[model samples]
Target: MSAEASVAAANFVTAARSFVGVPWRHLGRARTGLDCIGLVLLAAREAGVDLPDPAPYAREPQGTRLLEGILGHARRVAEAAPGDVLLFRLGLYGGHVGIASVHPAWGVPACLHAYAPRRQVVEQPMDDELRAALLGVFRLPALET
Candidate 1:
């Protein structure tokens, strides 16, 4: 990677890892306050990843499967790296997105998420459950160049 990309790659993991242990909340984004989407956007912005801010719910269509929406708009999962975009389904109906960041503390496993229910961005096990639910994992489109 180029020096600039390398620096961002490092920051992506470091910035997101800093949010671990934050509690979960709807529409929240800080250690004390952050929902899933907020966490994702926060980490990405903090890490210098370029992405659109969360749009209003009414302006966007519901019932759009996360996998469909993500793959349709973002890069593919195969090219994803630390600080890439992550898309996944929530408990039942909610589809969420976050920065595909890493967690050095967790044996350096590949993870990317801001879990509000648990508060903060956390690194999760890249296990079967994730494999089954993940719609897509993608890096920034600009980075691809």
Candidate 2:
């Protein structure tokens, strides 16, 4: 990554990390309070990336495709690149999504994620469990300035 790229990533990380330690609140949008989905959306927006919103979430996640917007809006592909969107497959319904923050970590790479309950952004290592649960990864379409 170039200096500009590094700076951009740093900015995103800094902004997202600010939400760490916030209390978990469902559908919450405050900077000091956010849910997993809310955190993901906030981080993406801060990174100057756009994501789907206004799509309905089910009363309970189904067997697959837990989020509707992710299913229709975020394009899914196999290619790996910086700033890609990641979707983790925890189970038939349990899933998570985050932005690809770093790669080539000797083992599992790292990504920035906003986890529920924590209500904050965290830099979680993409370990074997994450790798196995990784259901989808999508490029965010490069940005130039």
TM-score of candidate 1 on Cα atoms, chains taken together:
0.71
Question: lDDT by residue for model 1 over 1-145, one digit each (tens)?
Answer: 4667667766766777677677666666567866556666666678766555454442123654423433345566564567676666665543666665444566544665666455555678667776666766766544444
The lDDT values for all models are 0.60, 0.60
Off by over 4 Å in 1: 58-61, 64-73, 91-94, 106-108, 116-120
Model 2 Cα lDDT, one tens digit per residue, 32-94: 666566666676688776667633455345654545554445556784344556777645654
Listed in order, each prediction's TM-score against the native is 0.71, 0.68
* Cα misplacement distance, residue 126 of candidate 1 (Å): 0.9
Best by TM-score: 1
The TM-score that candidate 2 achieves is 0.68
